[model samples]
Target chain A: MSASEIPVPQDPADALAAVVALRRLADQLEDAAVEQAMRAGWSWPQVAEALGVTRQAVHRKHAKRLIAAGVKLRRRSP
Target chain B: MSPIDAYLHTVIMEAATEARRQGSATIEAQHLLLAVAAQEGTAPQRVLASAGLDYQAVLAALDREFDHSLSAVGVSRAAFNLPRPSMPSKRPPDIGATGKLALERAFASAPRKKDLRPAHVLLGILQAEVGTVPRALALAGVDRADLLNRVRDAIAGDGVE
Candidate 1:
């Protein structure tokens, strides 16, 4: 295959497989970015806003994992 | 339920959670391997930890793998920002073929009517010979054969003592 040519999937299975793989890669990038943001002292709301998500949604997804991984999180003042 | 059963469930559940967190639509063997390494105090966890393959270590290994993969495509994380794509629906992603194979092998390898342990899952992963776990472990300077031996040792009731 040529470098400039993107190969089309030969079958439905191939197409679906590609979609799954691409989504996984996206998730990995998101996780990496979120971790970097937290490491740089960004709050949950800030990170969520950057990703166009609500604070609750982002926090609900990542907070526990971040804590378990020993990423220091800033307190959100009420 | 036996402790082994509980631990295997934890590993599988954590692997699913990890897949979702990473935006992966399929659960791969690599994710299961990571879940085993991250579950603290488990036999597989201890074995991996002794080889410096803890959660952070595995993450670092994965980062390197991602970097290498991007470089292969002539892109770099430093070159551009990665877009954060959201899933269109709330439905969870399904397990991939390699992951399904590994899980089946894990069950087969498990002693009949006994709890399935992390070591069994680890062995299953190795046996599948697919997915990114082996590559990531290699990137982390882990000798696959040696690690396999250690995991077997743990399963044989050596490391728990």
Candidate 2:
């Protein structure tokens, strides 16, 4: 895709703003997916593996929400 | 990539990776927000839970914000980038020991590593601090929806819409 195709900031300040906007969009999408994964009987490692980040990064960032939501991670079937 | 692009690239790539891991079929605003929170340990998840904010409620608000942006950009969560997990990163994980543990658990808890996207980072911050800011937000009637919107606007440059 060309530079124009993607939503970029026209000015430096605007560019910064666009970055921020993109970041938020990225977060929302990430959270929804994580929520879905947890509900679907996924483990943290499973989630981490899917997310492609370290297990620790995912846990430190997401565990509390799952805990708060009372959504238990589905243990892998042995 | 410019400095901004470098950061954005890392954050976006992270989100895309997470989206694929979670198998949600699309990347949205919260995912990006989560990364922002977790990027350098902004601590949004801890703040959210301690304040007693509803997770779904916050997710809903974030959805609205994302829809608004997607209308501008066009596309759902999938049909974007998806990087496979190779070996673990050489660099140490970002957060402190406790924080690192939390992240590891988050990943371990997931069905896939994709589950631990950047949005988790933001949500984690909300839950991190149980007493100070989260408490204050709770007393003041703040919730995840409010945070979601603020975060959405902050990202979109809409200024807390």
Candidate 3:
């Protein structure tokens, strides 16, 4: 269904569930996008810039996760 | 060859060879996907092709992703070409954790031990919570849920060859 087609949650419980599900989907999207960028050989700074976050912020958030996931991350000379 | 053994000999070995060609030590999900896309007349290959993740498209997507990432870091393809040294194939390359999990999941999703098929592996890869398969599919603009539903329909509607 289109975003416009999605009915707004009327009940508090429904709203809460919507929020949780949205968060999970958002997490998956971010993770997938980041992993794609990394696999493409983008540096942390580049990813940070693309995401409009500081290099440190992006790196802090994703460095360990990418490493643990076995993504071949490389540090480019800035 | 038995279905399972044939799959292992062909698909798995092709992925391993791709990894070796790329100078990677471990066979990854992306390589496996590439292998699936390369094969003809298979359920997984058909699904991937229908989703626009066919062999050449996937290769281009991977290259584009890498180039895009590098460009973000102020690098460009025009700047330099990195040589990919082929690793010596002393033995078959080992499957990485992600690839292993995908295989395990594929087996688990199979209806019967003797009936393992590429569609199950495709479903497994789609359902993979972590790994290059999901990430690459997302980058390719595929709807994972839709792909999963179609695969299910294919399995139920017609038995995979």
Each prediction's interface RMSD? 8.5, 11.8, 15.0
Worst 10 residues of 3 chain B by lDDT: B80-89
What is candidate 1's CA lDDT for residue B36?
Answer: 80
**Could you give the TM-score of chain B for each candidate, in order?**
0.84, 0.31, 0.83
Error of 2 at B39 (Å): 32
Put down candidate 3 lDDT per residue, B1-161, tens digits, no spaces.
78767876788889998776654557877778788789898877888788877899888765554444333334454553333222333457799876888788778887777767667777776777543455456667778889888887767665545
Identify the superior model by lDDT, candidate 1 or candidate 3: 1
Chain A TM-score across all models, in listed order: 0.78, 0.78, 0.75
Which runs in model 3 stand beyond 4 Å of their true positions?
A1-78, B69-78, B82-90
The lowest-lDDT stretch of 10 consecutive residues in candidate 1 chain B is B82-91
Model 2 Cα shift for residue B83 (angstroms): 24
What TM-score, to 2 decimals, does candidate 3 have?
A: 0.60
Candidate 1 local Cα displacement, residue B103, angstroms: 1.4
Error of model 1, residue B54, in angstroms = 0.4
Residue-level lDDT for B92 in candidate 1: 56
Candidate 2 local Cα displacement, residue A45, angstroms: 1.4
Q: Which portions of model 1 show Cα errors greater than 4 Å? A: A1-78, B82-90, B158-161
* Candidate 1 residue pairs in clash (backbone atoms < 3 Å): A24-B24, A27-B22
TM-score ranking, high to low? 1, 3, 2
- State which docking tier applies to candidate 1: incorrect
For model 2 the local lDDT of residue B96 reads: 32
User: Clash pairs of candidate 3?
Assistant: A40-B66, A42-B69
DockQ scores of all models, one per candidate = 0.08, 0.05, 0.02
